[model samples]
Target: MNLSTEVRRLRDMDWGELDIKESGGWPFLLQLICCVLVLGLTLAGTYWYLAAPKLEELGQARTEEARLIRDYQSKAAQAAHLEVMREEMAILEERMNTLRDMLPTGAEVPSLIDNISEAAISNQLSIEFIRLRSPVSQEFYVEQPFDIRVRGGYHRIAEFLANVASLPRIVTQHDLTLEPMEDAGGEQLQLSMLARTYSYRQSGEEEEAP
Candidate 1:
């Protein structure tokens, strides 16, 4: 049988017909693409408006917390070091007080003169002139010094100065003088010196405060 006659017979025999057409298919596909684009744009806009700022804020907060933690640690270390220094200072103060308590107090000039005389006698030297000057202010201490002249042989004068240097308190000699005695033997010489001494007071004792 012919194809059209067979199709007609099939339609008349209570069977359905299939109709195929190409019209308006492009419009339907265009509508579908538009829907997909709209959906993608909506999702991107939601993310930009709602989630991006929160993520940025979370990152900034984390950085701030880390900086605060580091600052706290540094301050804690500084406080600890300060405490240790305070303890060390207390110990030093105690030691200084003990030393000050043990030191002697008397007229410094008489003792120094007697010591000088003893050194001269032991070394077989004669003291010609000894002059002492009042102290000058040098910070918290005094710069009490003596200018001395003596006549003796070279070895004896050296022995006398050495004995003077051996005293317990600190002494420094300056402006040394040595010359041959004109009338005496060539071995005899004159010795002149400026000798210095120091004195100290206890901590917390002050001549002036501001």
Candidate 2:
């Protein structure tokens, strides 16, 4: 039909006479609009029933894949550095063993005391006394203290300290006192001090002299 005739029929159509039974007589414009509405509703319902759920599942799968990739990369980096970590641990253990050797053993303590005595004599200091004090128990070791009294020139006392520091075993001096002897014309000095050494506390190790 001509466009003008269809336009006039749509405008003059009787709304009350429109019915499903007479749909063939309906205006072309109205039929076209009804067909477009039905098609749009069908497409919308199809997407809701089928495509929507699939799209949602696809999004969740992408997120899980990303998480798994990140986890794998982190574990791979740790595996790559595994050898370096082992070497570092070995170095740490070797250094620990060397430090343990620096601590004196029970049998060696007598020799260590004798060495200190020799150091005093070699520095021209007269030893008044060098006696062991009570040992202190610690978590990892024992503290062996000695009360040392001597008479010597000032420089000799200093030299004795230098010798103690250079000993193969570790010894430290604390609480030093120097007083001038009454009749030595200020040339002779009396020295009193606390000397400390350590013995490692290991199972089945002999206890050093108390």
Candidate 3:
């Protein structure tokens, strides 16, 4: 049919006379328009049902991929500097050991006393007394004090102090008093001092009741 005839037929079509069960008996124009409408609705419904979920899944997958990339970069950076971290740990351990070695044990106290006496004798000083006092307890270590009395010339006493200060173990001298011996005609000088050394306590030693 011509375009104008088809348009006129569509415009003048009667809907009430058409039989619902006899679609094939309908006019050609009416049937063609119904088929086009059904096809368009079917295509739109199919796209919404099948393609929407896949688009959401693609978006989630992209987000997960970005998170994994960030994790890999962080781990790679740590691995790159692993050797430097190990070297720093070794240096810290060495320094800790050196400090531990400087602390003496209980058994070594007598030897330390002997060393002090020897230092005094080496400097030509008279060691009158070297007595260990009661130990003072501290948080991490025990302070072992000593009462030292010596008689010598000024230069000899100075040398003895320097030698004691240079010992390997940690020792501190304080409360020093010097007086000339009147009976020795100002030739001999008396020196009195307090010396303290430290020893490490075992981990649970301080917590125990005496």
Candidate 4:
């Protein structure tokens, strides 16, 4: 048997008579085709088992790396503004201190009446009476209000009000009234007004708020 005889036998082979169970007795071409098909299936199964998981892990690693890069960029941007943020916080604290200083303390609130009295006396006005009212509760601070009555000329009353405005602590006048003193002189009048000041709430006072 030579290569041509083999080729002639292959060409004359009957396709309908082939049996997979009798592979050993099959023609050379059929056996070779069967071996190639088996080799291809084995390689495909090996790749699925060995390489597919590694490829999936590589894809996950790339995704994690991208997420980490984005996180680092965001933090670096925040870090660049850190000094400016600190400076702004310091300025805000200083402003808050200045405002707190403008508000009086609980013990010092009583002396505020003396301040108003001094202002009236210095302005040549007779202090009729200065009385303290109940303290008012608010969300952030306590408001201390007082009532003041004085008798004086119009210019002296105006000067007393201006002096009250220039006090070290904050004060405001409200509900002002003036009337003639009835024959002491036409120039003499009585002035009545409510004045208010503020104070900072002490620690542990928030629980008492209603």
Error of 3 at 179 (Å): 1.5
The TM-score of candidate 2 is 0.59
Q: Candidate 3: where is the Cα deviation over 4 Å?
A: 1-86, 207-210
lDDT of 3 by residue, 1-210 (tens): 687877777678787777869888666788898999999999988889988888889999999999999999998998999999899999999997897788789899999999999999999999889999988888888889999999999999999999999889999999999999998999989999999999888788954232
Best of the two (1, 3) by lDDT:
3
For model 1, the superposed segments whose C-alpha errors exceed 4 Å read 1-106, 201-210
* lDDT scores in order: 0.74, 0.90, 0.89, 0.88
Off by over 4 Å in 2: 1-79, 203-210
Model 2: how far residue 122 lies from native, Å: 0.5
TM-score of 3: 0.57
lDDT of 2 by residue, 1-210 (tens): 788988899999888888988888788988998899999999999999999999999999999999999999998998999999899989999997887888898688889999999999999999999998888877679898999998999999999989998898889889999999988889999999999998879876555564
Residue-level lDDT tens digits of model 4 in 29-127: 767778999999999998899889999999999999999999999999989999998999999999999989989987887777788888999989999
Residue 103 alpha-carbon offset, candidate 2, angstroms:
1.3
Residue 126: error of model 3 in Å? 1.2
Q: Model 1 — which ten-residue stretch has the worst lDDT? A: 14-23
Clashing pairs in 2: none
> TM-score of every model?
0.53, 0.59, 0.57, 0.60
Pairs in steric clash, model 3: none
Ranking of models by TM-score: 4, 2, 3, 1
Q: Tell me which residue pairs clash in candidate 1.
A: none
